[model samples]
Target chain A: MSSIAKKKGFGASLWDYLTTVDHKKIAILYLAAGGLFFVIGGIEAMLIRIQLAKPDNDFVSAGLFNEIITMHGTTMIFLAAMPLLFAFMNAVMPLQIGARDVAFPFLNALGFWLFLFGGLFLNLSWFMGGAPDAGWTSYASLSLASEGHGVDFYALGLQVSGAGTYIAGINFLVTIINMRAPGMTYMRMPLFTWTTFVASALILFAFPPLTVGLFFLIFDRMFGGNFFDHTMGGNTIIWEHLFWIFGHPEVYILILPAFGIFSEIFSLFSRKRLFGYSSMVFATVLIGFLGFMVWAHHMFTVGLGPTANAIFSVATMAIAVPTGMKIFNWLLTIWGGSIKVTVPMLYALGFIPSFVAGGVTGIMQAAAPLDYQLHDSYFIVAHFHYVIVGGVVLAILAAVHLYWPLMFNQMLSEKLGKWTFWFFFIGFHCTFFIQHFLGLMGMPRRVFTFGADQGWDTFNLISSLGAILMAIGVIILVVNVIITIVKNEKVGNDPWGDGRTLEWAIPQPIPFYNFKQTPLVRGLDTFWIEKQEGNKEGMTYAEPLSDIHMPNGSIIPLVMSFGLFVASFGALYNGEKDWAIPVLVLGLAITFASMAIRSIKDDHGFHVHKEDILKNEGGNK
Target chain B: MSHDAHVYSKSQTEYEYTRRVRREAMRGQVTTFAIMIFLTLIAFSAVAAGFSEYFIVPILLLLAAIQVVLQLYYFMHMSEKNHGMAAFFLYSGAILGFTLFLTFLTIVWWN
Candidate 1:
């Protein structure tokens, strides 16, 4: 109720965060949770590398190795990368578009809690009995044969989290479509906002297939359903089709935001307008559309018939045209501009050739016959890491440095950031580059260990050493974060001094209601345009300052997510535990009761009066 | 002042025009509802009349598709102005769903 800025006690702050529907606080929650999972996934990766560091090594048992790899892939993709990107999207997208908040703030909170609880439930598998060992894909035949409840955890946990992702996707789509400030036409929207729009569209269309596939898996395992039971006239290939249908678009959903982030960085540091802006937008939408048509490329080795393979092969290769257009666009963006070799710009410069390398390998695999040669080998492994790590991971590191000032009113050490970049970049290439040769040398992927006679000893050792260097880089990053937070050196808005968007126009330590008055975005890079026109405020007010309506924080989202979390355990234990049915019913009842209460209660959100806004502005000065 | 809601009194002519438009919309909705009921009845009768299984099934599907279009346009007011984005998303979802089924039929079930 207090409109003026005031510090709260620790418990009060904690309670505020727990009930917050504010996009900024929810973003911080996502960052912290996603960072935790990133580290966990990193540790799992290290375990993989250490186990493979030497020939015939037995650091982890074979079974545990499977579990580690599965968790690493599932956790990194579902929990770490996607949420980290969402963290950025939540933090910056609304600001870029000059919106006060996302369309559904309550659903936004629910999405975060659902993801957190789902991730928690999935990780709990390690302690409960075992983790899923059927690989991240969890192919039906393989998963159906796997013992214990590991695969069940995989299915149900993803079901809960995927729903969250789906909701978040719809939320973003709606927000971008409906929430742009006055004079901010669709064509005038920043590249980051445009890419977010397309990425959210991909998520909206893509996630339903995953939900359906996961449901099929859940029912088959838990309720004696025979959807995947080939012995009962079920076809196993259907799972492959469903999983890839979702999985292919899932990659785009991760990468498009990455593309958006890099596009922002490239333009910001270059001190120039994005090169071929419309084409960049065109390429993004093109990639999103093409993303759906080529899922079968992943299954070229599955003998989906020569005709099917040929059609998909051609479609897969066609994606490179748009992707290549993007690469050239970024390069041209940096060409002849007053480029600042800042940490983010450094990553953007590094990303071009690295992503191209990944894309070229992708084209190679698009040739169905060539894929047969590379399938299930270290080559396939190398190709994905190149795209994902080289592209998305690099963009993530860059955005961390770029948006650190925006998120927290402080700056990370520039020196430490550059050092982290070099170490990580070099380490990444060193780790995956030789894997191509190793794959060509006939070494396979997912094998726990190889014998000395396989001629892969030295390369595996090098790959492991590279992984160690990457870990050291990450450790340095963690140290950098700690140092930054502890120092808490406050920064002003436009900390980068070359900010090009509306986000940088806001005051430092941004208020909960982001913009006091909605900004009139005259064109792309609106802040830059304002700066060029000698505007001191870096903004043009769309209207006079007025009362702003803001949603109240609520705990219903957490309770609802908890209901699903509790229900997952019940479903996991069904047919085996005596109380499973009761637990299931109880959990659903809790969820439904919370829903009823939410619908019945009328919460007309409070408004900050113009008088309070004036006082707050004075206090800020 | 910006937050204050302003109540505007419409001119008599404007009020009459709005009333006529609403009445026309209601008529359209009622007519569409009747047509949807007729389509459903035809589908049900086709099933009950012991036609060839293939003939009945396709006809029922066709009728169902028509009913869906009517439902979306008339009942859901998708034909109204300002529903462009909603319509776009709905059709996109339909197209994507259709593609998935077609792919499934060709690749999974047929092969």
Candidate 2:
């Protein structure tokens, strides 16, 4: 067994990834799958823009256009953005806290598989019959009215994926709370880890509502349930309340980590400590708390009356103050320091102005009366794209550039990166900024097509042009990635030259098992402090050398998730087929059987001898 | 070694730690089960007592809220360390859930 562990070939490596429970390798899996989904979603976005390039254009049929828009929104949010963030969190958080792995590595792998299968099932609807034609929200009335298996795929797939998300959330919570290295106090933790902690907490509370909502949807469609049947004393609006209650926080869950990423980048590139660090932490917590309060703001035009609207409007506006505080803190951190305008720094700079524009418009919409005019319009679409694309997507791109060396031990070309950045930045604004006017000019959103002479022709054409530019920008990014991988140029630890966090202190191609000795965190920005004092070791040991206990990777998590994936199909086909019940029971029995084995089997982990550590200096030294 | 002595006595058994956690889990399960039963009884009684449907609905809602609290604290372990932060998150969700409910009722049911 030990001999086999020392080396393997391509087939063995592929099998290892399929079944392994290592958080770092699972992160790579997430990146590959999530990147694939991102491109698919991007192609869908281009199609929507093309169809809208001219009024009443038949670039796609009306039904097909709805499906494209729906898939675009759903894919971008659930499959692409969230998993990419999870990739970074999985890859970086344990290393930051000096832990060898997350608290439950098996569950981590299970989460990835569940998400991957769920996404695949949803996309398969395109080939089987049709895709979900309702909007991304899949509001109750529209979804119920839609025919075929589109909405069913939407409900079932989200149910499976949402469960995966819940498991991942719980795992992060336990890992952060229980696994901090000695001397790594809560207050001394990096901003990125703290945000991950808070975001996981949000996921814990938020996803259950979505689970409940999707369950109601599945029951309504497949079974004989009447939870959302308006004629049976059931209220369809309840679904809206449930969806947005989960949905609004889902927005913050994506953006807050993006904010955390930029916070780390700004401090590193500027060669200065974060200004007002404590206040920044306070504002982060405050934003998470207030994030739950503003879901009703999304419901303003649904007729909640004056007082309810007024109260929610005020509550929604309060979120802006803390957000404003964060913006100022980032600028102040770079105000009097040696700021290097690298590709990442350029994106961070771009984010400030772009996100601010999105923020102010959000404040404008917080006025209940003003929202009545903008609801279900292109203006709302523009607003979110600005916040999400302008803010979160930019941060993801910046992190790709910044953390490339940390994750892969290679640096992307700076020249190609900057070109990608400008094209994307300019094209993004060109696409979305004008949509606000189209909405005010009386164009409704989510309509598959519109007639000519609505005053939206030129703006829609311009938006389509911008979408092409954005695609070009994305292509350049792909080129940059391919070139870098081909060159495989190795970089040293602290490749950016001004690293401040614990993650940067670790050696490149970070060992599969991250830290040999737990690091003693002296203060905030521990690495920077040690650098100033001329400590070459880059860290003080928090503990002496000892045998490190490590869990063995297994294939059970994959099988368990796959069992549930198979059962979903059985449940969907229940009434039409004779084998449905048996198939469902058989699938569940497989899952439970694996779980029983897991509980009964006593598999204490193996240990790495101290000598093995000495021999492996080349790995992560 | 001295620090270890202060945190854990040499005579203490691993069994003691395991026993304590087991007791906590057991107590939590019992409390959560009791609350669920009590809430269900209240909901049923409200319907049987011929109360106005409006009154019955509100009473049922209140009982459901109590059950939610029990589940969160006992089953979800929200009452563990960092209780203040945990409570803050729960209360935040409750407040938003209430606002959404009220807004929907007002808009669709009222004028």
Candidate 3:
């Protein structure tokens, strides 16, 4: 176990990663997996764009187009964006808060495995029969009416991963609440930690409704349940209600971390204390609270009554106040400071206008009547891509560059990073900006192709061209990553030299147990404060050197998730396969047995002795 | 350390304060327990006595709600110091849940 840090063979490293519970290792695992999925989703995006490149194009069958778009949306949101954000959160949040690891390292592993297995199960649809084609939302009536097991895959796959998300969310909430280092008050916590806290709370409250909704969906399709079978006294609209309830908060959950990342970038590059810090925190919490109240805004076009629509419309618009406050705060943070236009700062600067554009459209949609015009149009598509791609995706890319040095102790090519940013940022606007006019010009969303006579040919082609540019940008990024990893130049700690938060205080090749002794956080941006006060070792130790207890890695999380994975197969094949019942039983038994073993086994974890700690020279400069 | 100090020579006043606090906690728990039992009986009797359906149903629900609060505050020690975060989260969750529940009752159940 002590030899875990030494460079080893691929097999050994693989085995270590498979069983390890260390947050740092788990973070790498998340990055690798999430990066793979992100590329896959990117490929799907390219395919969708190619199909829509020209009017009357026969690039893909209509049915296959449906599948492609669905997979693209589902994969990007559930698999790519969320996990990429999780990668950052897992990597940085604990470090930011001056904690060794998250509260439940084992559950952290479980969450990752569950997400992976569920994603695998979802993608397996491509090989099996078909992929879910009822849009990402999978609105009940359309989904139920659609033939085959596509919808089933959607329901069960999301169900599995949703559980993982829920677990991870709860873990973050507990970790943030309970695991802060001495003198690290809630008020003193970094904006990243605060965002993580609020997002986790959103995840906690939001994912349950998704779970229940998914179960209702699963039962409806698979087990002959009538939850959404309107013929049997079931209401399809209930699914809409349930889905949006989770769906709306899900947006905030994605964006808040993004907001956090950009906040860090803005402050770091600006080399200033965040402007309106408390108000930013207040806005985040207020946004989260308001997130729940306005789920009905999604259903406004569903005729949820004029009164309901009017109320929700007003409530939805109110969110803009806090969001607007955030935008201004970021702008003010950048005002008159020692600003460095690094690649990350470039994206952060680009993000303000992009996200603001997205926000204005959102408020427009909130008007309910305007939504009637925009619903199901490319405008909504443009709007969301503006938000998700503009905000979250940009943040992910920025964080990738911003924290690349922090994560790997190596610097990415600044030149290539800038290229990726310009190409992507410009390409993003080119792709979606015209789509707004296309929608206003009356082109609908999720339609694979339009006729040549529809007068949408040139614009569609432009959008596709923009997508191609974005793809080139992504390719450049991939190339950049390869070059960086291959070069592997060690740039020690605080490569940016303006790192404000606790994470940058830790020296390069951060040890498994992040901090040797949990550092005393004197104030916000604790590391910056210490740096200012001329603390050479980069921090003040809260406690003296002592034996640190660390959890041993176990394969139980993998086995438990595999149990669910296997059970999903059984559930999918329930009526058709002769062996489905036995398989289901076996899977459930495996899960229960694993859980029992976990509970019964007296694994108190191992301790890193004080002598060993002294021998390992870590962050101490 | 506190246990060792108690085992050694605790001041009379300190011991008395500790005992008094425990006694009060015990009394609160017992009182809440009795109230819960009485509420349960009332719920049962109201159903058993065949009152109006609406009356019995609402009454039972109200009693159940009260009992839950009693359980959380008394038996679960949520009223104690340092439980503010717990209380905040629990109530937040409850409020969110109730909002969803009300939405279902009003809109989805009919539609």
TM-score of each: 0.98, 0.89, 0.97
List the TM values for chain B, per candidate: 0.93, 0.65, 0.86
Query: How should the candidates be ordered by TM-score, best one leading?
Result: 1, 3, 2
Root-mean-square deviation (CA) per prediction: 1.6, 4.7, 2.2
* Model 2 lDDT per residue over A1-621, tens place: 121136688898888898888888888888889889999999999999999999889889989999999999999999999998898898888878878889999899989988988898889889978999888899998998899888888888888888888888889888988888787888888888988988998898889889999999888887878888879977888888889889989998998999899899889889999888888889888888888877878988777678878988998999999999999999999999898999999999999999999999899899999999998899999999999999889988998899788888888899999999999999999999999899888789988888896778999999989998889988999999999999988786888989898888886667666776778889999889889999887888887766677778878887887777777777767777888778878878878887888888887877776678666645433
Q: Evaluated against the true chain A, what TM-score does chain A of model 1 have?
A: 0.99
Candidate 1 true-interface contact recovery: 0.44
Taking the tens digit of each residue's C-alpha lDDT, what string does model 1 give over A169-254?
99999999999999899889889899889999999999988998899999899998899887899889999999999999999998
Q: Per-residue lDDT of B1-111 in model 1, one digit per residue for the tens? A: 147566999999999999999999999999998998899889888878899998988898888889889999999989989899899888878887888898899988897
Error of 1 at A397 (Å): 0.8
Give model 1's docking category: medium
lDDT of 3 by residue, A1-621 (tens): 232257689998788889988887778888888899999999999999999988889999999999999999999999999999999999999999888899999999999999999999999999889999999999999999988888889999999999999999999999999999989899888888899999999999999888998999889888889998879988899889889999999999999999999999999999999999999999999999999999999888887788889989999999999999999999999999899999999999999999999999999999999999999999999999999999999999999999888778888899999999999999999999999999999999999899999999999889989998898889999999999999978788899999989999986678788887889989999989999999878899987777778899999999999999989988988899998888888888888899999999989898877778777766423
- Top-scoring candidate (DockQ): 1
Q: Model 1: runs farther than 4 Å from truth?
A: A1-4, A618-621, B44-49
lDDT of 2 by residue, B1-111 (tens): 011223544446777887898898898799779879978988998899999988988888888878887888778878777687558655776775676567567765565
lDDT values for all models: 0.91, 0.86, 0.91
